[model samples]
Target: MALAVEERRETVAAGAARDRFRWWGPVGVAVFAGVLRLWDLPYPNAFVFDETYYPKDAWSLLQQGYEAVWPDNANELILGVPQVIPLSQEGAFVAHPPLGKWAIAVGERFWGLHPFGWRIVVAVLGALSVLILARIGRRLFRSTLLGCVAALLLSVDGLQFVMSRVGLLDGVSAFFVLAAFGCLLVDRDRTRELLRAARAEGGRAGDELRLGGRPWRVAAGVLLGAACAVKWNGLQVLAVFTVLTLLWDRAGRRAAGAWRPWRSMLRRDLWPAALSMVGSALVVYVLSWSGWFASDGGYGRHWADGRAGLSPERTPLVDVPLPQVSMSWVPAPLRSLWHYHAQMYDFNTGLSSPHTYQSNPWSWLVQGRPVSMYWEQVPDGQRGCASADGCASQILALGTPFLWWTACFALAYVLYRWFFRRDWRSGAILAGVAGIYLPWFQYQHRTTFSFYMVLLVPFLCLAVTQMLGAMLGPAGCPPRRRRWGAAGAGLIVLAIVGCFAYFHPLYTAEVIPMSEWRDRMWFTSWI
Candidate 1:
């Protein structure tokens, strides 16, 4: 009896050790990634790419509570040239929503409008995303090592690294989408556990399982809302995840031995899930426009007020008549807001302008065309380049080649597992990829860039890590086989890391000899 008790104690101790490792391992990887993202963040010292629009708009939002137009030389003024352009009170007509600019403003709020000031929040978001991915991987795969591998892969990915370093909306949107997905995963597990407990308590089959107060699902709703507020693309994720959550509820009921699992899930779970996920998300999305609502000078804030003079036929797409019903009780701002949304929708759909760096959605997975966010040719003796040939400094939004190529194969493997093996984890990962990727196909004729693929990279890494777990084989495999599998996976990961290093100069604006820059380009499309 003593021997048996001692063995049990040893097992408990071993489990405790594993739990501790799981908690700390991801934290360590996050710290490493954070250092890389945060180090020398102000190096470029200029507005890179769309930073010209976003950072300035962020400053306007901070100062005026709405995005205001600036003087003609606003870019030069903000970039610290001699010009003294002031932001006008008139609202700036921006294509995207205000939440992402608001997020950027948070950083500029603390620090002045320098490079680091506008970009700090994105960098922080990027680093935190690594931690979130690691934790999500742990929960999805039930292995801390795989979790760390996912985190490591994200930390070294060039596109992720560049998006994090720059002030961009997509990185912020990616973070919230990832966080929402993670929360839904937690909700799935919690709902299953609760159902299991209810079954053990002698509940009759087909009875309603009142798994009440799903805070995780509510959290997911809020995050998804934040994502939509950042970019409309997040709505795709919201739709896919809502269906996924309901399906999971059905699966949970079936596992709990409910006599009519689908019916019980629909009757018991549908409304509550909808209210928590869709209803809450709607509330959050509306609230995100508070800045626009609060400011009268905002663009289109008075769009409806002017309709009194216009005829119903004057409206291009939708016929609008003067308000007859005394919506006098209704706020004028809300009426104006409705009209503004129609115009914004038209703008978004009609945008088909060609861009030099625009890439087709089909080639996004293979990194066919990388958008150059910033570039400069330094003289022979400038910016620490002493070479006889002029040096090239650039910030190219590209993914590490080995990692992306490997993920392509892993994604195929995930499709097989999702269809044939009926793996829920594979389904979950693919759902994220589909939500972010498939919608781009609809807009294929419009200008899109590879950097938008930043949203899909986390899911790709997860898929790759899942395949790596499969490569490691079943838990009962021979030690020799496990060793070989580990060696093979490690070699692939190491190769990806090496590729990241080779492309580091391009991701950052590191001035390198022209020959070295050419060597890193690999393809003319990258230039």
Candidate 2:
């Protein structure tokens, strides 16, 4: 009897330890990630790659309530000690939406229009992404260890690291998508639990059940909308995920032994799900353009005010008064916004200008071509360079090679699990990949870059972590098999970390011997 009590006490202690680790491990990893992204963030002291566009736009939004044109010497003047914001009153045509720039403006409002100012919000978002992914992995895999592993993998990824350090829209958009995904995951669990409870409470299996207002699903919609507000591609994700959730509802009803599960889902769940996710998303997306709509100086804000054909007008081309837009009754601001969207769509789709660093989507998983966000040749005795030959400083937006390559295999494995084993977790991860990554394939002919894969990195990390969890095997497996599997998984993780360390210099604009930089460049295409 005494021994039984002792064993029970031991088991309780072990469970408590796991509970503590479940929280602390992910938090610890997030803190580590935050440090990696935030350390010396202001170094290089210049706009890196697309930073030339987004940060400037952000500053303009803060001052003028719209993106305004800047002078030719804006970069030089902005970098000076006494910074000058040379913003023109005239609005500029921007392809993407304003939410991302607004996020950067938040940082700039606090720190001024400097590197640290523009980059801080994204860096913080990036770190929060790590924590979010960790929690998400934990929920998906039912293992805190795997969750922390996933967070660690993302934290060390070169592309994620570089994108986080730079002021860019993709990383910001990715954060919203990830958060929305997490919200859906929570909704899935909550829905299942509610179904099970109803069944237990003497409710018939075929009874039409009404789950209360699913706040999580509503939150997911708003987040996905925010993602769209950052970039238009987020609309694709919102569409796919909306379908995914409805399908999940069907599956949940079927699992609860409901007759005609699909019919029931349509009858009971369809419209509510649509309203919570799609309706909320549309609201958030439009609201994100408040600055543009509110400001008279915004590009195209007055587009419909004096346009002859927009309103019924006697035109030379037509005998009767004819309106160019059939929906002439629409409000002017919304009509102008729609016209602006049409132009944005055309510009984004038609862009095929040649860029030296442009890469194909097919080559993204292999790190075939990395964008050089910043590059400079530092002469000896300058910028702390100690080499006899000139040192090179660069921030190459590349994924850690071994990690990415492993993710390729993991992705295949996940597809198999989703197809053959019918794993919901695998399907969810693949849904994210499809939403973010597959859309780019349609734009293949248009100029695309591998760094755009930043949006897909979180899903890839989740896949890799899931595979590692499988390698660790199920708990009931033979001890020897578990040991060997754990060893193999551990080695792969170590290799990923080692590769991250090896390429750390490239992710940060660290000055190193040109030979060393060249050595890290595994492919000529990477240059």
Candidate 3:
């Protein structure tokens, strides 16, 4: 009997090992994302959407610190061909910070500033996001295979795939957001193990167990900070993640038999975590703008007015004081830039344009209204040439319909586990959604688009696959049920892949007839 029990235990252990990373892994996810992003990359050959702004800014950033306008007809020149360095320093008004565009500039600088070269930065970042999501999911689900599956879904999603192929700021922001979330996951695991060990070793309240001495957590902080530096929306992740980390620390304290885990962390871990994550991020952010600070022609470069070289020195310029912001120490250009940011902030929150593609937070997960990035009327299928059949072709700004739909139901499961069972996994998923989604509610009146959800996609994919894996059951589940669940979920995945393929043309802006484009526009909002 004893021998039989031991053999059975060994069999279960082997099964668990099989599920860990038997097949799916980060490399597989990278390949999947790369295939989706790199195939037919130079499709329309023209810059799409706001590409008119970003790719040029990126190029300029590589050459100069600030955004400078290209020649009047430069758009046509920059479209399909690599060109010489543009020397004109005419100012261009831009909304977000420079880091994301600078990253894109790096690719354009190296690859000669064409569509693919400009977009290469976003594609690489998107690929990295897949790897990070896979690793994060592995840690979260405690199963590496499931983690890979999570990344696979994001790798193929229309929104994610399209964004990765374009020179957009959103995808870069998404990369940092996902990376930060992964870092927080590492912090959680490290802290948990430390908490467990301290209890095991009979450590006292004053005894510092050095729980989760995690460099990864610091990495997360830096990433989140970078996210913020990319766009202010990242501040939501910073605020939400900071609060969540503190709460986790509190829970860790209570679990570790500390009289005051929160207090202990306050005295020891909190400041260090802040400095590590926040400090590292601040340095990176400032460094991202090193070009901006170093150059005299930058938008806000005149702030210091020569008080301190490179540093925007604070100056008191209120002799004829206009407003309360008359700081003596802050420099002129810096102060002007500060005011510019204030105006930008108010503008961001106050705008209420009824954009055709603008979607509310509620519909994002289900993809109710996908933005249409590009469209054209193709005559009766000259490309495919079906005699009488008309095709509606397009680059629809939509996700894989079935994949996003699955996330809807999966998100519901996240809520169920978070509110009912207090599962930390559920909480973690919810925190991501909260960081991305909840803030949008206040901005509902603003001109927000569904594409903004791109940064939040990795976490949503993880949660969806996590719920799917749970439905598949563990190795201990009844054999018949486990087999049936795995089969069903596998079929669902197969269907999602099919949907991705069907939508691939639109995502990549491949030329199809107008009728086919109409067909892809499942809703009028998509048009």
Candidate 4:
């Protein structure tokens, strides 16, 4: 009796310690990520890769409520001492929606239109993403240790690190998508808790209980809409996640012992779910275009006024004739917006122009063709280059090789666990991967770069952390087995850290000897 009591006390103490670590551990990792991203953030003073387009557009949106034309030497002039921002009054036809530029504009508005200004907001979001992933992992796996591991892995990923430092839409949009996933996870837990509470109150197992408006689900919809406002790809994520949440609802009802759970799900949950997720998302998505709707100079803002464009009588891709005569009651602004969407769709699907850094989506997982965002060759004596030979500085948007390759195996293991063992956590992580990744396969003919894989990194980290938790074995496992598993998982993490350190220079555009840089390029394709 005495020994049992002591064991109980010890177990309770351990649980309390873990509970305390949960808050500090994830926050510590997030802080570390922030320092790495924000340190010397303005190193490459000039525009890197696509920075020229997005940052200028952000400035235009800040000034004119729409993307405006810039002078030919805008990049050079913007960086000049006097900072000549010669923006034209004419609006430019931007492909992406405006929210991401607005996100960048927030930082630029306060810090001035410089490198640090545009990149600051993205860097902060990137760090926050790490914290969010950590929290998500904790909730999914029920282990603070595993949550910290997931966050640490994301903090070191080269692609995430680089994207955070650059003024691009992908990183900001990724934050919203990940946040929505987190919200859905919370909604899942809340739903199960409510079902359990109803049972505790002596409610019948098959009772069609009405859970009041799911605020978490609604929040998720708003975040998804924000993601779509940043990029069209977010719509795919929104669709997949909507289906996922509904399936979760069905499962929840079934688990609550409801007979004919599918029927109950449709009758009781369908409308509410649709209104909460899809309806709210649609509203937010339309509201995100308020700037475009308000601006007369916005591209296609007046397309209904007899502009020289293809008639909206038919859809662009399918050539399906629309009943425009009957639908003429729709507002002219909405009509112009619909027409603009068609033009945007055509541009997005048809963009196959050759690019030096373009890579097929199939090769993305293997880091086959990392995009060279910025590169500069330098003589040995210039810019802290101490080598006798030439020096090289470059920002390569590549995933940490060891971490990503390990994740490939982890992904396979996660698939097995989800398919064969019916693990819900694995399925959730895979949902994110599928939603963010699978859609790109259809666009393989278009020019795509490996850097876009940044959105998929958090999910990959979760998969890896889950696999590591498995390696660590269950708490009831034999001592020897647990020891060996811990050793193996620890070694893998150490290897990932070493690999990240090895390639840190390429990620940050640090000047290094040409020979050293060449050595870091394990594959010629990476160059």
Candidate 5:
């Protein structure tokens, strides 16, 4: 009797310990990633790549409440040429939305127009994304260790690391998307738990059940709206995940023994789900444009006035009427806003201007044609270089080759699990990856780059971590086999870390001998 009592106490203690293992693991990894990203962040000391556009635009937004056109020498002034670039009253025609620039503006407002000021917010977002991913992985896989592994992989991914250190919109958009997806995962489990409880309470099959106030799903919609506010590409994720959540609802109802679960879900859940996700997202998206709406000097603010006296034209191809609207009751600014969006839409779809570093979406998964965001040829004596040969300093936006390459296999495995095993988790991951990636295929003829793939990296890391969990074997596997499998997975993760270290110089613009830089390039395309 005493042995039985002791054993019960030990089991209870173990369960309590497991329950207590929260936050610290994910928090620790995030801090580590933050330190790496923040270390010497202001180096190279100039706007790199599209930094020429975004940081400047952010500063304009901060000072003017909207983007303002700058003088021809604005770059020189911002880079400390002893002159202030005065903002012109004319509005600047920017391609992307204002939310991302607003995020960068927060950092610029605090730190001035220096490199650190513009890049800091992105680094912070990137670090928080690590924490969110860790928690999401724990929920999905039901293992804290595997969750940390997922976070670790993402923390070390080269593309994410580089993007974190730059003032860019994609990182911000990616963070919001990841956050929304995590919230949806929480909603999924919460709904299922409610359904299970209902079943236990003697609820009849096919009975309409109302699980009230799905706060997580509502939150997901708001985050997705924020994602869309950053870039239109987020619309794809919003569409895919909205459908995914509805399917999850149907599956949950079925699992709870509902007869005709699909019909029950339609009757009991469809309107609420749509209103929570789509309606909330639409509201947030409109709110995100408040800065533009408040500023009369924003680009295309007078577009409606310009079109007020013009007649609609017939299209040459189809004889369809060209879109024209005259809403006398609506405020002029709102009509102008609608016209502005239409013009922006046309600009986005027609962007085929070639860029030096453009890569097909097909090559993004393989790390082909990584963009060199910053480069400086430092002579032997300059920039702390002691080597006899001249040095190459660069910030290369490339993924850790080992991690990305291995993730391809992991993605294939996820597809197998999604199709054959009907694993919802695998399907969720694939949906994210597909939503971010497949749209790029439609724009193959346009100028796109592999750096855009940063949005897909979090999902890839999740898929890889899922595969690692499988490699650890089931609970029923022999202890020796499980041990060996765990060791192999650990070694693979370590190898990926090692690969990241080897390429660290290129990712961070560290001064290294030309030969060493060439050795790290590994491919002519990378050079």
Candidate 6:
């Protein structure tokens, strides 16, 4: 009996130590993520790719309430000399919503109009995303090592890195979406705590349903709203979160022994959930347009007043509700702005451009096609090359192969956990990918590219780490199984990091000899 007790105590102690492995893992992963993101952040010297759009648009937003037009060939002007280019008063019918543009503007204000300055915001946000995933993983897996693994995977994802180092609206959208996901996570813990408290308060939760006022739910709504303000696809994110949170609420009530879980949710969950998540979201979204609302020059600011381009059929009387009704004084620009949006929406939904980099939605997970952000000929015998033998060089925008490949398996694992284990962590991953990727299928004919998946990249990586943690089995599997699991996961991670380093030059637009560059192209599609 004494021997058995001592053996049991030893097992408990071992389990305790295993749990502690995650204590400092997040910090180590953080340092790794930050270092890789910050290195050569402003490489390529000039705006590498879409940095041309968001950074300039951000500057324009700062100068004006809404997005305004630039002179023809504005990128060249912005790229050269003084480098602080502002937009003209004429409104540009930007296809995307304004929130992301505002985020870029905020970055520009802090970092100045330089490439490094604009990129600083991207890097910071991307790093914060890593931290968010780490925290989420820690909470979900109850293992710090697992969380760190998630962060490490995200940090080394070539696509995420490149996206982070360039100014783009997608990063801003991703930031809000991740924030919303984090809020839901917080809500989960808070709800569980409430249930525990109810159980302890002599309220037998085994047969009685308990409900709690969830603050994190409100927080999630606010973040989702911010996402919508940033991009239209954010609407999809908001929808997914709404369902995911409500379902969580329902599950919470059921676990607490609510006699009618569905009824309890409908009665106690529906209204607050709607107002808190949906209503709060609406408020946040409108607030993102505050600059446009305040500025008289904003495209649609005076639409109600009937300005230029307002068709009689589309423009309603502006003074119907007002005491001082006078259509004679309405602004033309506002009317034009209203019409502009309708047209922009039409254009976006109807976009059918032949983009070389565009890839099908089915191909995104495997990275079947990499967008060529930039390419130039290093003529034979020229510019640091013995490439007198026809050298081919290009920046083929692609994710690190190891990172993407692991994500594939990770996502599959998440599917298993979501359905079989009914894990909330797995559900969150579903919400993110569904909102970001699945919707793209409907817009298959539209001009879309693989780079947009950068928003889902972190969550995809987290899915991978979550599986690794589960496979490792709570630090209590047979010694052989544990050893193999650790080794396998470690090797996979190391391989991903190695691949990231190998592709760093192409990702960062490093000028390489044609032959050397072509050597990295494992796929014809990559060219």
On a 0 to 1 TM-score scale, where does candidate 6 land against the true structure? Answer: 0.87
Q: What's the lDDT for all of these models?
A: 0.89, 0.91, 0.78, 0.90, 0.89, 0.76
TM-score of each: 0.94, 0.94, 0.88, 0.95, 0.95, 0.87
Which stretches of candidate 3 lie above 4 Å from their native place?
1-24, 80-85, 205-213, 303-326, 331-337, 380-393
What TM-score does prediction 5 earn?
0.95
Best by lDDT: 2
Q: What is the per-residue lDDT of model 3 for residues 1-527, given as tens digits with 9 covering 90 to 100?
A: 99999999999999987765544467777877887787767666777777888888887887877888678788877763555645677656677888899888888777777877888889988888888888888888888878888888888888998889888899999999988888887787777777787788785733365554578778888898789878889988887888788778777877778787678768767776777777887777767766766777776556446443322332233223232333557656555556446545656667787877788887887888888777655566476646355554467778899988888889999899899999988898889989987888886667888899898788779778978898899989999999998998898888888999988888876666556665666776666
Residues 168-218, model 1: lDDT tens digits? 899999999999999999999998888888888876633576788999999
Misplaced by over 4 Å in model 5 are 1-16, 81-83, 205-207, 306-325
Better of 4 and 5 by lDDT: 4
For model 5, residues 401-514, the per-residue Cα lDDT tens digits are: 999999999999999999999999899999999789998899867888899989999999999999999999988999999999999899989999999999999989999999
State in Å the error of residue 91, model 2: 0.5
CA error at residue 96 for candidate 1, angstroms: 1.0
Candidate 4 is scored at a TM of: 0.95
lDDT of 6 by residue, 1-527 (tens): 99999999999999888666655567667777788778877665576667767777778788877778778778777667765465688766677778877777766787677777777777878888888888778887776767878888888888888777777777778888887888888887887778667767665453354455678888889888988887778888888888887788778777776677777778777787889899999899768777777777766555556333345443232313323333444465444545556656667778888977788888998889988776666666765655566554455568888888888988888899889988877887888889888999998788888988888887888888877776676666799888888887788889989999898878766667666786788888877
**Can you write out model 2's per-residue Cα lDDT over 383-451, one digit (the tens) per residue?**
899888889999999999999999999999999999999999999999999998898888878999998
lDDT tens readout by residue for model 4, 77-145? 888885556678887888899999999999999998999999999999999999999999999999888
- Candidate 6 yields a Cα-based lDDT of 0.76
Residue-level error in angstroms, candidate 5, position 271: 1.9
Give the distance in Å from residue 416's predicted Cα in candidate 6 to where it truly belongs: 2.4
